[model samples]
Target: MNQATRNVLCMTGIKKSFSGVPALWGVDFELRPGEIHALVGENGAGKSTLIKIMTGAYRRDSGVIEYDQKSVAFLNPTEAQAAGIVAVYQEIQLVDFRTVAENIFLGREPHRFGIIDRRVMNTRAADILERLGLQIDPRSVVGSLNIAHRQMVAIARAISFGARVLILDEPTSSLTETEVSVLFNVMRRLKSEGTSIVYVSHRFEELYAVCDRVTVLRDGRNIVTRSLSTLNRLELVCYMLGRQPEEVSKGVTAFREQSQNILDRPVLLQAEALKYKKRLDGVSIEMRHGEIVGLAGLLGSGRSETVRALFGAEPLESGTVKLEGSLLSLRDPHDAIAAGIAFLSEDRKADGIIPELSVRENLTLAALPNLTQWGIVSRKQQNELVERFMRRLDIKAASAEQKIHELSGGNQQKVLLARWLCKNTKLLLLDEPTRGIDVGAKREIQQLIAELAEQGLGVVMISSEVEELVEGSQRVIVLRDGQSIAELSGEQKNIKTILHAMAEGADRQEAVGK
Candidate 1:
């Protein structure tokens, strides 16, 4: 391929800002035809912003975008789609209640005599799926399909729009090994057909398996772009983290050296052989007072399921839970709460907050019964408690009456934490507590977690960020395929050790299956 003909898309000196805060600082990116280019970075490394600008979800402050040898600036996603740029996000965006065909041809379906043409739409959808080597029923309801199939449908929809540049963001996060294999096959087919793909994922193995080249971004700037053949995993991780291998090793050593003195503390919560259908398999966990235990695992590794079962959010098929050496029967979350357990879900927007409620209301939600008397709430008590936590947790709000939605992500999370604290819970369960927040907010939350642990509240934290898990928790339990594989403490509680345990767990499982 000639130099000019090989370049399918080129973006130069792209700059974007949100409320005077720079997200992308004069970054450059390019994609060659028929190659899968991986875009990778930490949560706030500006990958999302750059992708949005490329897909026309956001307008760039200043940049030059050349596509197919022609300079073009698309004002919206529709325009970008028309120009053959499309994206399929991690969260599948399709009408679950509708048929797969209807979802694929939505908004621009074939029509005859001013009426929708179902036959034509189904035929087209079936053809696209077949071309993609997906054997899904186009006439079937989208909701009836598994997560992998739903993802395939989304890809089919994007291809139907004539996408030349396809962006796949964390597409295999929730898929099984078999499903990921199928997706990889589809990606290989797309690449062979000369479709330039932009693949974004946190899984290093997946990227190495499928991508030809990768562009690493750090602190909103282009750090490096190199072919996978030339770049080692350690070098890529160092570039993304802005850390040297020696520095990372030293940090891990320091963390292990400064171990906390919580070994003498009595057990606060104990779960024995917790089982929940296919999600959890004989999971047992023990937490001591004034101790922070970290749960580490990839998606579908039973990390979240273990916590849900402990908090009684999901019915436990077997096993027993004990608090302070006494058997505790938890039929539901209310019982768990009554037994002094609080769970903060990973999805903060969906389960953590009531957007329309005031800050005071959300903060005092769980402790409402305690704040009430004679079937009437004591407004004075509620206000006093809310004010205390708001100040203590450093929740920023104009007033306690301010709507929870008006605050930033960090403040919203603080409100949720306050809600649980007001109940005087003995054990706290936090899942992805620092996700989707800025660096400053993440630090504040980490500090708060430390403070809570010091105050003798046992904490079970589940985080996808390996660094956070290593630094925040004295003990780390590694889970794999619905089973707890290894428990690391002190010297064993480092990133390298934890990752080795996870990989070994996967290898053992594969061997057993074979």
Candidate 2:
């Protein structure tokens, strides 16, 4: 059969915009029956916009969407789903408090005589999960399940809709290697059954392993589409980055060069055998005065937990935290802050910022005590501090009174950074600092991190991006199953070494369990 005949989904001349800015311009995409097509791009490459258009979450300004050999315009996600098109995003959409079976058949439960049929729904949900090779109980609450299981439930729910075209956007970002393999197997089975799958991820290895064809998008336009067998890793990266492989390598090396001289700095902070319930087990780490230490691991590998324990967000069961060789007690964030420690949480919107507050308010929230006189804030002193930080951080805000929510993601992050800097923090704990921001902002933030380290601030960074971890840190601590498994330093801090350490740690843990 010809390609046109086998195409299950075809998008042509797709044009979409937001508030006069074009996100996708004349982008064309196609998915063949029974084939796993990969949609690859850097952040803001219009990948999500195009996917939203396809799934009817967004109305395209102009486009032709052909599905199942028929031109169709879906009015909403429900319409798209009814037409056999389903999308499973990175963030699971299921309700955590609800049972798996209830979530699966939510809003469309089996009914008899105006009453819900729980048994029928549970049986069907269990069957769907079993078919996907997931052993989770249908009656189990989603909140009690692990991230991997939650991902499986999302996929199972998609399948339950009798979807012919499945769109997975970063489905395995939080999953372990074993869970990824299981997801790949499920995708293969769906492909064999003539379902078209659109797999979107930044991980090249995953795309190469499961996808038959690759489509690269850049600047809201389609760059090229090629078969996986014909394109090598370097070629794929070059296409996505629009730069030569040598240039990319040089960029990485340049970032690495900044951290080469910080190895001999005096120890600034140390955690000895930190224990925090079941999340952290004797996790010990040390940071020097002018060094950045990266924590590398999978989603449930205790990277976030380690930082939380160190920052006193989560109470440590047993541990000794020392600052400059003196043992200290960090009973809460206030104590940590008093000791010149600052933490920028991973969820910026949820934990880092108060959206309704102005930039000045959010920036000065932490350092209010210092800026206050008696029981009231000294406006004169507060103005001086906010202005200094705004200028120092180059935060792009209309004025100090501008709402933080009105600023771009990058600027909001800069405000958060300035909050800690205002307090004269000696150590900064940055968790996924560059996430959800654009490329230019990411580069600026990374450069700022390096500059801060040069100024003698100890930084403990945690990022899901391996490139950031490799380029920004002088040392990386690999964690697995709540334990500090390995530490990579100097020349060992490369991506290959970190991945190898993680894999080895997983193997050793498996052996011990056996």
Candidate 3:
């Protein structure tokens, strides 16, 4: 057989650029029929670009794409789908108002002599679902089904198209462990039926469980392609991050070391056995007065969910939250706030600040009840409180009357901090407080957090940067799949330790294609 036709799909020297800036260069990728190949890469990598080019969503600047021994160029995704190459992105593409059968046979419905045949379409869709081991009803609304079933419906639609090559991007990102297990079973069934799949995921366990060969792309280039069993988690991470295992160092943030043994301080907040649907599974933590405890985890690792649970934002399955040794039952954010707990959300624009409001109004929004008397807000009280915090937090703005949206990211964050401080918040929950801000602003926030801790305020902070979490917090609590797996304090609080804890227990003996 010729080299180009050797695999079911092949690309050679694929290069794509935007305005003279190359996103992919000398990229060679191949897909063999009946094999599950894993495409792994970090953010800003060429993974999306390469996938788009291969799927005809974008035209390649220079490359040769051969599918099934025939060199073809598809102008759009519809053409690619017509040619038996289909992709199901992370965001499920389906009409909520449409039925499952309708979504499956949407553009290509069975017809009966100038009239659509619903019976035939339903039967065909049901057959495909049954074959894929899914029991969903054909007439069920797509929106009425859960994410796992919706995904299976998508796969069934692809199978209906006779898709020889299927690309699944982050298929298990929102799935539970049990749902993930079911998805892997379906994927194995597809592989046995001679369907090639491109599995893209960040979960190390899923790759070992379902995929055969792994390809790592970094810095707009293909780094390595190897058997999943050959490389460990650290090596794979190193390839994705373009770093040696020993090169993963710390001290990249502006936080200075703090005093240990703050454990003797009064326990401010104690949460145990926190469970919220699939996001939080038995997460527990203990925070002391004037102590900063960091929550470190990958995306969707329950870091944000844990803090939200503490804030009474998420409905819990079963848990106990104690503040100052008093068992507190919080039903909503109002309850949490009334209990003297303040929260600074990760998404400042959406959850924290009202962009249309003025700096003074936003700062005094949280303390409105105190500033209000007999259903009237005292402008004098609000203005005085705003001025005091503006001077204290160094919130630079043209004037307190200026809209918050006009201020820089750092100044907006300062105003938000002042909002919580004016309410006499006991335990401050900061989720990515310094995120989306400039370096100088981030340094200011970090310094302010340390100063707040010194003033005897208990803080629980969530940060994606391992160095920030490790250095800023007196202790770091690592979360994985909604579970509090490790709590590092003193000597154990470091980047390497947290990364190892996050990746531990994921490597299983189940070797792919052994």
Q: List the residue pairs that clash in candidate 3.
A: none
- Number of the predicted model whose TM-score against the real structure is largest: 3
Error of 1 at 421 (Å): 3.7
TM-score of every candidate relative to the true structure: 0.75, 0.69, 0.81
Cα displacement (angstroms), candidate 1, residue 456, comes to 3.5
lDDT of each residue in 327-433, candidate 1, tens digit only = 98888998999998999999888999999999999999998998889999999999999889999999999999999999999889888998999987999999999
CA-lDDT, candidates in order? 0.86, 0.85, 0.87
* Residue range 254-315, candidate 2, lDDT tens digits: 24455555557788988989887656878989888988899987545688988887788989
List ranges where model 3 is wrong by over 4 Å: 1-35, 39-80, 83-103, 130-150, 173-179, 192-194, 200-202, 213-227, 238-245, 248-251, 506-514
lDDT of 3 by residue, 1-514 (tens): 7676568999888999999989998898988889999998865578889889878999999989999989988899999999899999889998889999999999899999978799999999999988888889999999999999999888888889989899999888778788988889889988999899998887777888898899988768999999888888767766775555356566667777776779789899899999998789899999899999999776567889898999999988999999999988889999999998999998899898899989998999989999889999999999999999999999999999999999999999999999999987999999889877999999999999999998899999998667778789998888887889788887767666667776663232122102
Listed per candidate, the RMSD to the true structure in angstroms reads 5.5, 6.5, 5.2
Q: TM-score for candidate 2, please give it.
A: 0.69
Error of 2 at 446 (Å): 7.5
